[model samples]
Target chain A: MENLIVEGSHGVYFVPYVNFNAETGECELAGESYLEDTVLFYNPLLEWLDNYINKKREAIKFNIKLTYFNTSSSRCLLDILNMLKDFEDEGGEVAVNWYYDEEDIDMQEEIEDYEIDTGLHINLIPSTDLVKHQEDDDDE
Target chain B: MEANNLEKKAQDTNKFDLFKYHSLFNQNVQISYKGPFDSKVLSVLGTYIQFTIGKNPKASKKIFNIFIELAQNIAHYSAEKNLFGVEEGVGSLVIAEYPEHYAFSTGNIVKNEDVIVIIEKIELINSLDREQLREYKRVQRNLPQREKGNANIGLIQVALTSANPLDIEVTLIDDKYSFFAITVKVDK
Candidate 1:
């Protein structure tokens, strides 16, 4: 399966970055998401997750690094997380990592909420160090 | 005693000068909508305000966010439901341009019993400085997620984006309902 990459207007669309890899079983979503059509944007992503989980052949690692999202987007996010939770319940190996800006207390809380909402252990990774690394990569 | 008298005279003179300046600054514009907030209208107006004010990108984003949040709040929660089939929520939204900044205000009828909770929430948000407000939002976000429509994150987002305290006033309309007005300013 090829990766899904769509460049969206940050702060306009609820999810700014999305990377779903079929071969690597790595999915990453980042940035601010406040999409006009929440259902339309999320449906395909949901289908991909469902396929990954149902196959039982792919080990998945999902990463979320969203700074801001509206309440509507939050509901849709919950839907996505619950799907992953169901997969975990079925004895699938899945790891979810959430990266937030160090100063963004709100983002930290959001990750916690997702953990509570999904019953999945989300690795709350602070982005300050990771951001510096990413910047160094860019320089290279 | 002499210093007090001199201060009084100075204040009176300053008030008179301010009144004269206010009379000279006569530029005012009022845009009002009564019905469901048409996204079409909002989009056009949002662009117009951005261009007219020549606001920075960040400020423009904040204004747009505030507009969308407040309009949605009215659409979803306003007690005065629109009778017309075209509009789902009935309320009045106004945006006025002042010399220094733009004032965005919204008013709608709310159930009397619900007024206290809304008022308290607004008051709590308004009283906090930026740091406290950020902490409060963090605390609220960490709580267990609700099934649906339960997170009050909208208010927090509005406050954060605008970088201005929320101004909320409530007036009793009747035994069952009250008029709630909320206003916030966005700098150019």
Candidate 2:
């Protein structure tokens, strides 16, 4: 499977950056997303994950670092999480980490809600300038 | 002749007073616009909110998100048309500032029959407290997209973001259309 790379744009609408690697099974979505057509934009990312799990059966690592996203995009994010959860249920290795602005309690709560909705443990990481932060910290 | 001249002056003064309230530069409103809800207009309004809110990132973020979510509602669902054959929707939006919070309001014409559904949605949103609203939003979000009744997800998000209940007012215009206004308060 080929890798997918999309450069995000911040114009009349915000588009989040997406990078899904087929070889490493590492997918990262970052930046702000308030799209003109949310589902249309997210369908490919969903498909990529579909192919990775159904065809390759590789271990998947999904990293999300969106600063902001509208409700529609939030639904799409749930779809991604649900897909990962299903894959893990079928004995596939999956990890989901969400990085958000520390000041945004709403966003932190949003990630928590996703965990409750999908029944999948999501790692919530606060945004910081310092690189190489430890992942074993508390999961607030 | 003098009496007639005085009456004419009175009429002119009344017209001037009406114009003052409708003026975009009216001091009562921090920002106001009446036109099509196009991308260009959305960008300008977004920047204006950011600039006006200044250093309060928290308020700025809430107001901006609320504005975008509601403005897009007008753009997508308003019964009125701007470009006619084109797909753009037309409406009016205003942001009024107060000591504690900014009131963001958007109004658009909708089919008279649709007013009840709109009111019911707003009422449902207003009836819920913060936690219930979050739960409602989660359930609604999980539903498949493109469902007709589920379009209020944007409104739900606005409530979640602003942490304020929606204040909605509907004014019947004619047999076919009514002006529906939804307002949200974003605290500074």
Candidate 3:
């Protein structure tokens, strides 16, 4: 399976960055995701995870560094996180790191909700580190 | 408080100033648009709102998120379709900035029969605290498609995001139609 790389854009609708590596099973969804068609945009990512879990059978490291996501996008994120939870439950090695704005109480609550709802342990990282990493990546 | 009086007068006289102007009320209206609530329109309007209120990051974030949900609510659920060729949710939206909080208001027509369920959803949201609202939203979002009904999780999300009760007004347009309006306030 080839890697999925989507360049996130901030036009009329914010599209989140998606990088799903077929080789390493390291995926990261970054930036804001307020899409025109929430399901249409996220369905492919879901399919990618499904394939990785079923076919690849490799450990997955998922990183979500989103500054903002609307409710529609939140539903899609829940779907993705639930998939990861299923994979973890099946004795698959899965680590999910969610990076959010530190000062955003709403985002913090949302992350907590996702954890309780999906029954998945997620590492909460502040976006301060994520920001420095982005800056470094930009320099490359 | 001269501007306050003018805004009250406008609201009392049912004369909401549309567009970028202080025609008959205060300059509280930061943004106003009335047209087809399609994806293109939503995107542009969302951007405009972001730009206009970008000064206050916290308030901007709350209002923007609420605006998107409410705008999409209008886009997806509004009964009136201004455009003929496509499925469009046509409605009106107004964002007013007061001293304390920013108010996001949107309205569209709905079928009279559905109004009861809509009110029930709002009342349910209004009845809950933050924790209960979160749980309710989770339960509703996790429901099967068949059991979901039209009471969308978006409404609950709107309530949670704004951290304020939904102010709803429904007017009977006719036997089959009623205008449903919702206003949510986000503190600045």
Candidate 4:
């Protein structure tokens, strides 16, 4: 399996950032997502996780840092989180982290809800730390 | 007879002005629009809401998120549509600024039969307090999304994001059609 990289867009419709590394088994989805066809956008990401779990069977670290997502996109997110929980259940090493704006009460509650719904220990980090790390990565 | 006709014309002009500037009654309305509701409309209004409301990013984002959900409801569920090749939701949206809160509202036409469902959804939302509303949203989120229309989670979202209870009103246009309006107020 090859790496899947999608640059997020902000236009007539918002698109979230997606970066899935086949070699390292590290995946990240960030930014806002409100697409014209949401299912079309998220299907491939779900497929990537399926391939990683069924084929690679390696340790996976998933990170989500979304500022806003519509209700439809939220469902797609639940699918991704549930897949991670399943992988964890199958003795696959999976770690999921969700970074949200500290000031955003709704996003914080949403992360908590995802944790409760999936029964996965999602590490909730503030966006400021995420940004700082990204800047450091760019510098390196 | 000429004087009577002049008086009638003057009265008509006054009525037109009153109708046109009805918003003047609440002069704090920061933004309002009446037209086809679509993705383009959301994008434009979303940007405006983000940038216009001072430096409070969280409040602006909340307003924007609430606006998107409500406006999308109109775009998807409104019985009235613009038939210019591709159909579009025909409705009106207004965002008013108060010292205590910002009120976002959308109104559109719906089939008389569908009004009951919408009212029930609003009533259910209004009944729940914040924590219950959150729980309700979680449960509904887990349910299967409808194949054709909204997953019926939009009102739940409005309830969660807004500072006050959801205000829903329906006016009968005729036996076949009715106008449905819902408002959400976000505190500053």
Q: Tally clashes: model 1.
A: 5
Residues B62-178, candidate 2: write the lDDT tens digits: 888888888888888889888656576889998887888888899999999989987888899999998898889888887667842223488888888888888989999999999
Candidates 1 and 3: which is better by TM-score?
A: 3
Task: Please write out the lDDT profile of model 3 over residues B2-96, one tens digit for every residue.
Answer: 98898898889998575435464468987777788877778777767777688888888888888887877777778898857668788988989
Per-prediction fnat values?
A: 0.11, 0.63, 0.52, 0.70
For model 3, the stretches where C-alpha displacement exceeds 4 angstroms are: A129-140, B1-24, B83-86, B145-151
lDDT per residue as tens, model 2, A1-140 = 99999877766777788889999999999887877788789899999889989999989989988877887788888899999999999999999988888889888888989999999999988877423221211221
* lDDT at position A31, candidate 4: 80
Query: Which residue pairs clash in candidate 3?
Result: none
Which DockQ-derived CAPRI band holds candidate 3? acceptable
Evaluated on the second chain alone, the candidates' TM-scores are 0.74, 0.84, 0.83, 0.85
Error of 1 at B30 (Å): 6.1
- lDDT by residue (A62-109, candidate 3, tens digit) is 998988888777778888999999989899999999988888999999
Off by over 4 Å in 2: A129-140, B1-28, B83-85, B147-151
Q: What TM-score does chain A of model 1 get?
A: 0.84
Task: Specify the highest-TM-score model's number.
Answer: 4
- Flag clash pairs in model 1: A13-A34, A14-A33, A14-A34, A14-A35, A15-A33
Using TM-score as the measure, what is the rank order of every candidate, best first?
A: 4, 2, 3, 1
CAPRI-style quality class for the chain A–B interface of candidate 2: acceptable
